[model samples]
Target: MNAMVQSTVPASRTRLPRKERELQILDIAHARFAEHGFGAVTMDEVAAAAGVTKPLLYAYFGNKERLYSACMERAGDAMLAAVGAAVAAATGPSEALRDGLKAFFAFVDGDRDAWRVLFDETLPAGGELARAVAEYRDRLLALVAQTQLELIPEHSRERAATEVEALSNALLGASEALARWWLRTGALPAAEAADLLVATVEPGLQARAALRDRTASPSTPDRDQGAP
Candidate 1:
């Protein structure tokens, strides 16, 4: 049986909880920072956008630098989650690689300004923010190298190892550059840009696969004498 209870309740409005408010502040702050660049955004601007007082903004984020850092962290996490989810769902290396690139481009499409802050070296200078972005990039490169290694052919282990690292870095740089170009020219759909990237990458990946196969050792058949 389903029971319904009724109570005399007031309809007073409630403010967003502190935790939610902080997230709201961060979202607005991230957009502002991305739109105006780090230096051009201010606490008051963020506060106004957030519909909060400057003091409230300060209470949550402390300062512009900290706010910038928070935005970077959020953007990086979002980007990684998208790529990681795509990679996890893929059944094969080529598909995984393609999906990862698509996820990355989708992220850039959704959060262009945030991606700019995280990828562009020209943003807020020096200190922890720069260090965080550098660390994130390094980690992303490592993941790319790992993914490439998985796609490497067994016969060409040595060459594949050397080439995958280079290819990974090249793809990373090219994706970032292409995203920036897309932002500037608005010439291609994000999917088209990702497809173009995949086209550039596939030949090298095919070479790696071919090398592995060519170098792989053949399995031996059982002798007629016994199955030992």
Candidate 2:
């Protein structure tokens, strides 16, 4: 009777494929870190949440820091890919900025936790992890700078590079702030939030483009008086 009862019961755990298991662990870890921040969460908590042994978690991710890094890398890479693809598909500078912002907000809206993981302020003040995060930010900044530079004519790009980079930094900062606010308040839909940002910034961007265009174009020469 005892043997029969034991046979009837299911095992506590089932083996998963390696990639599947890794992804599962990452998803759980990502959520935990996002909710509690890296400093407060523990491997045991994540292991329990993931229904895995602590040894297995360590075997897979090596340590808590590594697990955190993995989460950051995944979130950051996904965000960059989404925004890059959106920008690549755009027909013009304005479209690129608008599409990129939409893609960014869409990503945050789809997974607010992932956005938190990517931009967690609780990360160590200075370390390899912080450096890694900075590298991701730099990559994003470069992408935005390139997008901003697109608004300037090719001939003016060299001279406008500094201003474009500054504008890119400001745009990224504003977007991050707005996203956090959106997450906190839920005041606007993702598309509308993106549109609001676009509306606020596009006029200035267009004005800069126009200014550069005028500056770069040679002034029209007056026709010779009384000459055919």
State the lDDT of candidate 1 residue by residue for 108-141, as single tens digits: 8987876877876567567877788888888778
Question: Which stretches of model 2 miss by more than 4 angstroms?
Answer: 1-12, 220-228
Q: Give the per-residue lDDT of model 2 (tens digit) for 1-228.
A: 999999999887878998899999999999899999999999999999999999999999999989999999999999999999999999999899999999999999987888989888888989878988889889889888888888888989999988988898899999999999999999999999999999999999989898889867777343565433
lDDT of 2 at 105: 98
Q: Which portions of model 1 miss their true places by more than 4 Å? A: 1-15, 154-163, 212-228
TM-scores for all candidates?
A: 0.78, 0.87
The best candidate by lDDT is: 2
**Global fold similarity of model 2 (TM-score):** 0.87
Instruction: Locate the minimum summed-lDDT window of 10 residues in model 2.
Output: 219-228
Q: lDDT of each model, Cα atoms only?
A: 0.80, 0.91
Error of 2 at 208 (Å): 1.5
